[model samples]
Target: MPAEAGISGGSCPDFIFPPAETPASDGMTHPRNPLAAPVPLFYTCPMLTTLAIRDVVLIEALDLEFGPGLGTLTGETGAGKSILLDSLGLALGTRADSGLVRTGAAQAMVSAGFDLPADHPAFALLAENGFDADPGEALVIRRVVKADGGSRAFVNDQPASAATLRELGGMLVEIHGQHDDRGLINPRGHRALLDAFGRLDVAGVAAAHAAWRTAEDALEAARTDIENAARDREWLDHAVEELNRFGPEPGEEATLAAERADMQKGAKLADDLVAVGAHLDGSDGGLAALRQAARRLDRIAPEHPLLADALAALDRAVIEASEAEDKLAAAAEAMRFDPARLETVETRLFELRALARKHRVDPDALADLRDELAARLDRIEAGDAGLARLEAAARDARAAYLTLAEALSEARRAAAVRLDAAVATELAPLKLDAARFRTVVETLPESGWSPAGRDRVEFEIATNPGAPFAPLMKIASGGELSRFILALKVALAEQGSATTMIFDEIDRGVGGAVASAIGERLKRLASGAQLLVVTHSPQVAARGASHWLIAKSHDGLVTRTGVRPLGADERQEEIARMLSGAEITAEARAQAMRLLEAA
Candidate 1:
């Protein structure tokens, strides 16, 4: 068989162990099985296709290509296996240190290339960060660390920040180890994982929560308004009443001022008119004298032409004087003024101005102030009915939210039970038969509620019988912790998992069947996605569809670390070398063949 035959486009038959009976809600016995029934592999192309490292620690220059399925990396201690991971981490935007550069190199550079699906979340993230990313195009992230302790990051050759690279890295890869703090190890992500596993829909609950908050905000605002209005209730009533009795109109102040000025001027003009009237009224005035002169001149005008002209001039003077006296009589009639009416207008103007001063507003704005005060008084009187309606709305919203949250909580508890049972079946084959796994689903108080609902989920474990269960990190040994993480991953079947997963020394302490079990589970996980495992176990190495041997070599005065892909024969020889220390024996070779055949 070819060395990489099972690397892609293949499946392994499901291994059926003795069933561990779990009670179901239907009162029937169900088999708790960790190894799911065989399904076709979903991914044939690797997401991460290439990694290139330059002048990073002992790696002078290295470029590696990868394929889908399990790829094992094995080397002796201090043979630079960790260096490869560190180089990958640099490209993934981990914190950079100047010391990561080679001894005499000016800088270190690392690039990672990926063939992500068009619908991957990283594309959305890139767009949100102002980077133009097209679907169906290759993605490459590069990082350069300078010897002077400065670093720069790039995505597909475009300038990018390290923070962006970090976020993208989170979506692309998950690294699980004894000390890993992200992915399945973090409690903050536990609830989300559980929901994904159970395929629970949380949109309804989230929508209800938002509605409740909005209603509560409206109700609280109404209550505050009613309280403030009540505090000024008596003042509002008095102000409204005073302004209603003295109804002011817009432009009323300007009109009154104009009228008062006209009346004052009229009073002075009336006195002048009286003196002028005396001169135009009597029969001995200018009018009568001009008429008498014209009549005497008319009789003598017939005697000569000059006499006739003089007579015409006297007749015109008489007519002009009579018109003047008529106009005087009309003025005297129209300029008549009453002291009582003037007093009334002045009194009204004074009251309006005083009211404007009391309200600290312009005279014309007093009308608006009156309406506002009346509205306030109206609200204070009608507050109870309005408050009652708002209170009912808030109550209904709260009840709706509680209903959705309670249903979600119940679903989570049921999923937790199933997850615990699935995890239990994985424990025994990995040689933790005495240990027990538990998924805690606890309900938090209302204040702790979130859009996700009010349940807090955590995965806990106990290593021995009758022992108290604690968090996996706190209770399990380093080797046991790695195994526990593997068990959890196997049960989850990659639900909520990243596209590529890496395991560092997951098979550290165990040997024989336990090592074989770990290899089987890793191989099963790789059938659907891609995995890179850094391991020392020969069984784990034998299970890989592709093998890489990491080694340290020296030239003249410089030492470098290198990785070499193994062919069929070379893979057997390497596995034998891993089986027998320092030298490969015939028996070890035969045993390696058997392991490969079994895989």
Candidate 2:
């Protein structure tokens, strides 16, 4: 026991389990072997691994720890604990509330510390960031929120995002409260509770959920695919028909466009050539008259130089007309009209424009339509096969999911029986004898994927005989829920309790023996987990391994709240005050002392 009490050989020697952190010999139940006499199992203090708060709503300076067994926090109603939790929640990946920033603060910082047990999953998270955390070393985190409205988080002083913090936080904590944003309030939380109680080992559960979700998503996508196919089936068929009719070659448009332009101007060019030829011919055209003039001039020019000049001018005119005729012929030959080619051009242009109007696309994009329309039609026609495949796949997936879910439900059912009994046993001392605790596992195959299961897992209760059994969530008053939660925690102790469990005056309505019972259960739970309770009940506080006093102080205008653990003598007096209201009576002090000794 002495050796077990010390830190493992890897950690610093002075950094031992805190003395007050150990379990007390209050003869608690042996969760492993309940039939045997109750045994007081020894436990070492849990390491303080990490803490952080940043510019998060109302947080000024955030400092805390990865604490162990029952580290209780106490303050007045609005002493900022809730805000602290909100900041932690946000840092862990809840939605970032820019409004959380203090009015005068610029940005908020949140951070956490983790002590990896050489194999904690958080180590992998750290490794992803390239930080090689030492084995057995505490993973320290710090976050600073700037007064100017910006924030930063660090793991071992290395930068990280709020998302990473959130991912890691999920594995680190499971906060339970009837009305909290966490826990059973969200239906999505149901799957997690089942998983936790089912004893699933990490990757297995995650993988199963991944596969299930993928299958579910595929089915949904297939439904949409089918709907869309039906919607466009008619349009797709029409488009494919039109595209096939045109049968336009891929590059036909460019070739036809060039040919059409040349043809449109061909007649004008030919007309010019004909006019020049006629003129060049005798009397009928320019060339013929020029030739006739040249002949007359030539006959006279045998002696006159002026006649020679007139013949040269007529020759120049004839040459010009001959050149124009050749130019027009060349133009006509380049156009080279084929009736079939012209008809093809007109047909293609008309088809392209008609398709363009039909599909609301540019003529140039007709080729694109041909491919698109054919593909769409093919898909619509093939949709029967696709939908069949999807539905088949969905059925298979749902079956697989149901198989596991049913198996889990069986485990839960068996566990629920024990759970109910265990809770009932705890309630015995709490004075709820006639009150029955029941776990009702309702499997609703019709209800779509809830985080919990196909089954609506609700805790049920019959507080009084003949009273209709109703869901624990709805039927139990706040006090009953607290007690129910406590009893559930007691049953789950062996599975491992949260590092810290805080019950704010959970012992409020009960007194005398019931207070003692609550204290006893807390003590029993504290054996494996830490229990922090804020209480006015002396019985409850008497069972605390350590006591803290939350008080207010004023230094000038600054009002500050502080917590300090009470000494043994101080504990005696405080318990007396709690027992006797405002005054500390000798009898009350004596009773407190006896309670302390009895504890």
TM-score per candidate, in order? Answer: 0.70, 0.52
Per-residue alpha-carbon lDDT of model 1 for 1-599, expressed as tens digits? 11211223343212212224444434665543343233332232337889999999999999999888899999889999888998888888899999999999999999999987776778888999988878689899999999989999999898999989888998888877667777788788889878765556688999999999999998887788679878878787788888999899988989888767666766878878777766655776667777788888888899999999998888887777778778876655544566777788799899999999999999999999998878777767888998898889999999999998998887778667777776776888999999999889999998999889999899999999999998876855767888888888876666555758889999888889999999998988787678899999999999998999999999999999999899999889988888997988999999999999999
Give the best candidate by TM-score: 1
* Model 1 regions more than 4 Å off: 1-46, 227-382
Off-target runs (Cα >4 Å) in candidate 2 are 1-67, 73-116, 124-135, 143-151, 163-167, 174-179, 184-408, 431-436, 444-456, 460-478, 494-498
lDDT of each: 0.81, 0.61
Model 2 lDDT per residue over 290-363, tens place: 67778877788868777788778778877877787677667668765666777777777777677678779776
Best by lDDT: 1
Model 1: how large is the Cα RMSD against the reference?
14.1
lDDT for position 316 in model 1: 80
TM-score between candidate 2 and the true structure = 0.52
